[model samples]
Target: MSAGVVTRLSTLDRFLPVWILAAMLLGLGAGHVIPGLGAAIDAVQVDGISLPIALGLLIMMYPVLAKVRYDRLDTVTRDRRLLLPSLLLNWVIGPALMFALAWLLLPDLPAYRTGLIIVGLARCIAMVIIWNDLACGDREAAAVLVAVNSVFQVIAFGALGWFYLSVLPGWLGLPQADLAVSGWAIARSVLIFLGIPLLAGYLSRRLGERARGRDWYEARFLPRVGPLALYGLLFTIVVLFALQGAQITGRPLDVARIALPLLAYFALMWTGSFALGRGLGLSYERTTTLAFTAAGNNFELAIAVAIATFGVTSAQALAGVVGPLIEVPALVALVYAALGARRLFSPHVSGSDRVRQA
Candidate 1:
């Protein structure tokens, strides 16, 4: 890539989250004043699914998947310590904590609380890449983690859904849970969202490798797709937030309440995973990469499933939508924090050290 292209890519990487948040606010404001705009946009459904929103998410997930180096799966699998922490944080600890927080804080709003759990359970799909890059993480390891998480999510979503409804309530001091999420519905959503993008990305990569050189593929195609993916994600967030603008205005405090647990979750996961990776004697990059992989959530999939399982008007779906609103900004901050802390921990000679030693 040319210096200018590389510079532009870096700039976009820095500010994409800000742009997403701006799009969401702008869309929400417009939807509120325009009254029926959100409804009309949301009404553009196909086969009982929101076509525009779904397309946006699909487009958003494409770039992340496109970067997956499937051949490196063996290398990642060999790192059992990294994989174990990721599984525990994402599947065991993350989901459990989210359920407890949702139930405790949103006692009266079952749908919203349920939506939060759904989002948490879905795990990281896209933003992990951005965070991993920001933290200067192991690129190959991050790619393999993404692929593994995608595969596991498809297989475990149904079982997780069942556990969320059947088992989570008792642990949280709540009454019997009665949420009805069909296994088939979870399976279909996973297949349509996660499976399609993964296959498409894999096929595209394979074809690009055959047709064009790796240099051309990375420099020409990958760079182009990265920003497009972020744009697509932001656009979807805009539409979803717009659709629920009125509710957000009415329950502004609700955002704060939900954000508390999310913040806690992020901090705990990031710290725990980072410490674990460090104790295992992994490099700084691998540690941060694994930390972010464990910390981020695939909110897009969560929102999609929430809307499908519970009506778009339901607070559950709205809660799922709200996650990205808080997370985009929070994660951006975490990205910078991770990057800034690198010099302090990295064994590689710091620039200042080199200058002083010189």
Candidate 2:
């Protein structure tokens, strides 16, 4: 990369928080100014998947996946130690933490509690890359973890949701009844949001390289196409806030009530991820990647599943909307925190070396 481009990229990274907040304000303002705008856009869905959300996810995820070194995937498997921690954190610890937090924090708000847990269950697929990038995380590791999480989300989300949302509530003596969500329903959302983008990113990277050359593809194509993901993220943020702006505006206190547990979840997960990575003596890059992969939530899939099972008007879906409203800013802050704390973690190592050590 050219010196100028490197400088520009750093500048972009630093300003990401500002841009995201601006998008939120603009989206909220536009939603209030133009009545029914959010509803009109949100109503455009196919098979329980919102088309705009799907598109935004596609744009956000493709570049990140495209950058993955597919050849290095084998190395990831061979050195399986680093992968286990993140898997445990993502699937086991993360979901359990959210479930506990939801019930503990929102005892009376069952639908909202369900929504928060759903967010936890739907690990990162789309925006994981942005957080990883912002934190200067190991890109290859992030890709591998994201792919793994996507697969797990498909198989586990429905059952876990049933276990937590239904069985747990009744088990805890809550009045909420058990609701069974079809596993395939959750799978459909994953396929639309994650599966397609994974395939397209792989194909686009391969074909573009074959057609043009490695040097041009890496230098020209990557730089040009990379920022599109951020744009897509900004667009997603706008739409999300636009959709839920009025509700948020009307009941700001309620929004704050819903946000409390989510904020706690992010902070706790990031800290634990960092400590675990360091305890295992992983490199700074891999450590940050693990932190983000575990910390970030796939709000799109969560929102889709929420609406499909709970109805568009349900508080469950509204809680799903609140996911991005809180997550974007929280993750942005964590990104900066990770970058600043990078030096404290310890000796930087190459990806291969880090994988081997972990």
Task: For each candidate, give its TM-score against the true structure.
Answer: 0.83, 0.91
Model 2's C-alpha root-mean-square deviation from the true structure amounts to 4.2
Each model's lDDT = 0.72, 0.79
| Poorly placed runs, candidate 1 (over 4 Å) | 1-9, 104-111, 133-135, 171-173, 304-310, 344-358
lDDT of 2 by residue, 174-288 (tens): 7654555777876776677778878987887789889998778777777777778788889888888888788778778778888999999999999899888878887778888
> Residue 61 error for model 2, in Å?
1.5
Location of the lowest summed lDDT over 10 successive residues in candidate 1 = 349-358
lDDT of 1 by residue, 200-221 (tens): 8888788998899777876688
Please report how far candidate 1 places residue 131 from its true position, in Å.
3.8
With candidate 1 superimposed using the best TM-score fit, by how many Å does residue 189's alpha carbon deviate from the native? Answer: 2.6
- Clashes by residue pair, model 2: none
Q: What is the lDDT of residue 187 in candidate 2?
A: 74
